[model samples]
Target: MSDLTGSTDINTANLPIIDYSRIEAFFFEKTAENVAENAKLLRAVNDVGFIYLKNHGITDEKMKQLFDYAKEFFSWPVSEKEKIESCESKFFHGWFSPERTSKTRIADQKEAFDIGDDSNLVRPNQWPADWPEFRTEMNYFFEKCHEIHLVLLGTFAETQGLPKDHFDSFVNEKDHFFRLLHYPATTPDSIGDRLRASPHTDYGTLTLLFNDNSGGLQIRGKDGQWLEVPPIPGYAIINIGDLLSRWFNGSLKSTEHRVVEPPPEWSKLDVEGRLPPRYALAWFGNPNRNAWIEPLSSCITAESPQRFEGVWAGKHVADRIAKLHKDGKAPEVWKDSMYREERPQQQQQQQHAQLPALA
Candidate 1:
């Protein structure tokens, strides 16, 4: 997550709700209607920088199971939870307690657990042996999410006036990350740092978020107002990230967003249970670890030259973690800036084939 400088004012103007049912048509077809869809996508990225995506083909039941596993894991006693605490792990990829993680330079007061594919970036994901269903559901979800991100990349590439596979070479064996985050409920009077996560842009390419009914996610609109991203049933929220912004030469936004206290209307507190905690599963789509995340040459011009240096994707991730983890933790393996280079070339190739270039 990028801790971007932004505003806290509420936006009256609405964010767009997009239907992804036509994604197949747009990614696979070269027709005029598909052209229109591509334009629609570009508009969302330029204007709101985020969209409510429906007809994404993920089942509500599966998402619910994902939540069930999250709740179960978090319900364990402190000692039990300590068995897999992030501070104890070499890669900092396990459970991070509420008060021990900072986002906006302040303790986020929310808990999270991160998982990623086995890679040179760190190591194999650590799964709780007792939670077999958790591993199965999460792995399944990650694979499905990978498919979604590929289509998204194609649309973005096509819209940026590049071949549909313009970004394909850089995306092989991507370092996709899945995280389970929870912001526990507090009485209105007891609310401390109301922002669960402070305003920040993600360091990755695309961020797909699945949230429960309890709403608090907010994004800074172009007008300098923060717009509420209420949870829309059956819709998974999608937003561009800093990597995409550079690729599009900032014509597309890496919108700044944060989780803050929801207005009363958006709150789903129960009188008996008091305030109920909010749970969300975020899938962060990143590029290959060795790929240099520099601005695309096609996107640069006489007026807008490259704005950022090429950051090795793996180093960018480790650097970000070193800054945010309250305990300042990172695996010793992460000390080297270019560890991915040590891996064999063929191992870096993706199991999936590169997407075909658009004609």
Candidate 2:
């Protein structure tokens, strides 16, 4: 693996690369080669929390199609895309325009569409009426990512000395989210002090990120310097999230990361003097709503006592989502967001009556 470090970029670190084909082979039969690959995976996550996964099952054609779809969707006029604005959904599903979803003073210079499981009764997906293929293709990709999540989850469990199927029960209800993100091309004046994505740690267990290799993604190193994360073609960037860090009792890192403005040299300017836009897909793997998340016993020791109280996976995620909204609070009784508080009888009845058909 090549290190990102250069004389001018002395702070950058070289992140480990994991081969998913070997991980798959190890899942079936643990030969020495496969076992070594497994150990590399465990060490990478524990030390850096982010790694590039090559030979992952998703084909290049599929990824290209998804990116093409994202570009087409983002190219739509703002008014058309706003029809399914995420604010319209109780569970924060659907489209969010640029600058509308930020929690920081510097707004994120990107728009996104969030999709949850089709079978989620309260979190129904909102689709663009004009793009039927978008829905079909995205759902297909979503399922593919979920399959990878399961396999990775099994590997994590086995590496932690638990049964390979230990996390299987927790994900039975599939409380995951797949997001399509679009960062519009930028000019110096328009993007002054703004980032494509602000620094933040993800709230779920793992985040599988697919990018078009436009660069600008960076993770904060242990030494408190930002390290560039170069995108490698056909490799998905995988990172541990807060939930998994908690579950592992901080044994695994949940590194802070962000997407900075693309360097001017990376893309040519359009007629409008904007750099080329960036597109990416992020699949967040979360446990079921009721799954209890606590430090595993194996991760706890005298040197590192439990640092987190057990919390419901759904509630924890819901709370994080709420913080990004202007109100900084979610509905007290939103079942779809998985807030445990009970809703008033009349409200519950009305919402149930108007529930949309699952996508």
Residue 159, candidate 1: C-alpha displacement in angstroms: 2.7
TM-score of each model, in listed order: 0.82, 0.86
Instruction: Give candidate 2 regions above 4 Å deviation.
Output: 1-11, 98-105, 270-273, 327-359
Q: For residues 71-102, could you state the per-residue lDDT of candidate 2 as single tens digits?
A: 99889898888788886345778888645554
Best by lDDT: 2
Model 2 residue 326 CA deviation (Å) reads 2.2
Residue pairs with colliding backbones in model 1 are: none
Task: For residues 217-311, write the lDDT of model 1, one tens digit per residue.
Answer: 88876677787777776678899877777667776778888777766676756876446788999998888766666777777889988666655
Q: Could you tell me the lDDT of residue 345 within candidate 2? A: 56
**How many clashes show up in model 1?**
0
Determine which window of 10 residues in candidate 2 has minimal summed lDDT: 327-336
Residues forming the 10-long window of minimal summed lDDT in candidate 1: 350-359
